[model samples]
Target: MKIRIMIVDDQALMRDGLSSILQLKEELEVVATASNGQDAFEKAREFTPDIILMDIRMPGSSGVEGTRLIHRANLPVKVLMLTTFKDTELILEALEEGASGYLLKDMATDTIVQAIKTVYSGGVVLPEDLTAQLFLDKRKTPHSDLEPVGQPVDRSLLTDREWGVLSELGKGLNNREIAEALYITEGTVKNHVSNIISKLEVRDRTQAAIYAVRHGISTTYDF
Candidate 1:
């Protein structure tokens, strides 16, 4: 089955260009296009695409707000942010709003295609050169002493297999990569991921990864 997608960009040329390139891929289908965040949100409900490539800045209902609304609505769609800025605060805001990944506007065409596929297949995507900076900036920022809103996490609740899966998630490894590392099938990895999400009580792998990293599991999971 082809992956269904929506392209949301304020620039007509950008939207058309991306749509044109994506249409050439046999495994992908551009089901919809929106000029702004509000339009994107509405079209998302109408088309119900598997993925949305969203611009960070828009005239009305910016991408961050749209992403939050989509997440709050509990849609099954995954959002991948498209932006020209590497601004740490902006990226973190999108992530906090439940964006699955962020990609630069100038990224190579092949990389952009693969990023959509990667996020669609349940992996977190960030520009390779910018990931370290993002993490470091986030860590340096002071967080409030108040606990985050969620069930108190107890790593003890995870099984040995789930621990392995959680560790890989923290490292941003997709199902296929996790399968190869653990000598399991991709189907098994998917099952493990679902089980881990349930156990962790998180919205998605991005949240799961943040939880794992906070508990120090990510330190050893790195490549």
Candidate 2:
């Protein structure tokens, strides 16, 4: 089945270029396009595409507002933020507004396609550069109160083994990768992931990973 996609950007060139590239994949389909968040919201309600490629900055309305609206409306559409700006505040807002992933505009077309597919399959896609930036920010000014917009989890509660699991998650490792890295079985990794999610009070591995980063629970050695 071809994955339905909606492209939202203020620039015609960007929307067109993304559409053209996405059309090359046999498993992808462009269902709709919008110039701003308001238009995107209207079209999204009408078309109900599986995914939306949203630009952070727009004229009429911002992608963050649109994502919040969509999320509040309980739509099934997953949002993948595609933008040039990497402002940490905006990125966090998008995630809090229910974006499935974030990718920069400078990423290769092939990488964007893969990111879409990954987000479609219920995975998170954060740029490696952004991860590095978060780590650097933590080192420069360690905010003890930094937490994702939700009930914060106490990192002190996590067992040492669970910390290892979450560190791998911060690195964006899947169960297999985590198992190999930690010299554990995949089943063990899965169990640890589940426990981590429960302890963190997050919905999925993606949210847990975000929490790990925000709480400084992720170790530099893991990366």
Candidate 3:
């Protein structure tokens, strides 16, 4: 099945360029385009595309706010932020708001297409430089003692082996990589990941990683 896509950018040229490029890909279809965050939200509710290419800066509402709204709506759409800004804070904000990935505005068309597919497949995508910047920002920020607001985390819920598996996961290791690194079977790594997700009350690996970071449970490992 072709992956349905939506473009949300204020610039007409950008929207047109992205649409033209995506139209050439047999595996993707550009279902709709919107000029602003509000329009994108409405169209997202109506069209419900598999992925959305969102621009970070817009007149009415910023892409970060829009991403938050889409996430709250609980739609199946994954949002890939496309923007010219390289601000680390902005990128982290978007990710926290539930963006699946981020891409630079000047990136090649093929890269953007690949990012859409990667995010749709439940993988997080970010430029290596941006990813480094994100980690650097995290490290530079002083650790806070405040706890995150949610169900209290149960440390006893995860076994020591499971915690080790999640430590690898928080470092952005895939199941195969985790297995190879830990000298374990891929099936075993998968089982550990599943248990970790269930214990953490997160929907995906990305969320699980975020949870680990927020709680300081997996901060020693680098991504």
Which candidate number would show the highest lDDT if scored against the true structure? 1
lDDT of each: 0.81, 0.79, 0.76
lDDT of 2 by residue, 1-223 (tens): 9999999999999999889989989999999999988888889999999999999999779999889889888888999988755456677678878887788889898898888887786567765557556545534555634533222455476787898988778666678878999999989989999998998788778777776665445554222
Q: CA shift at 194, candidate 1, in angstroms?
A: 5.3
lDDT of 3 by residue, 89-197 (tens): 6666887788876888898888888778777765566554455445555556678233442224565878878877876665546677779888999899889989989
Runs in model 2 lying further than 4 Å from the true structure: 134-156, 159-161, 173-194, 215-223
Q: Which candidate's TM-score is highest?
A: 1
> Model 2 residue 171 lDDT?
61
Q: TM-score for candidate 1, please give it.
A: 0.79
List clash counts for every candidate, in order: 0, 0, 0
lDDT of model 1, residue 38: 83
lDDT: the better of candidates 1 and 2: 1
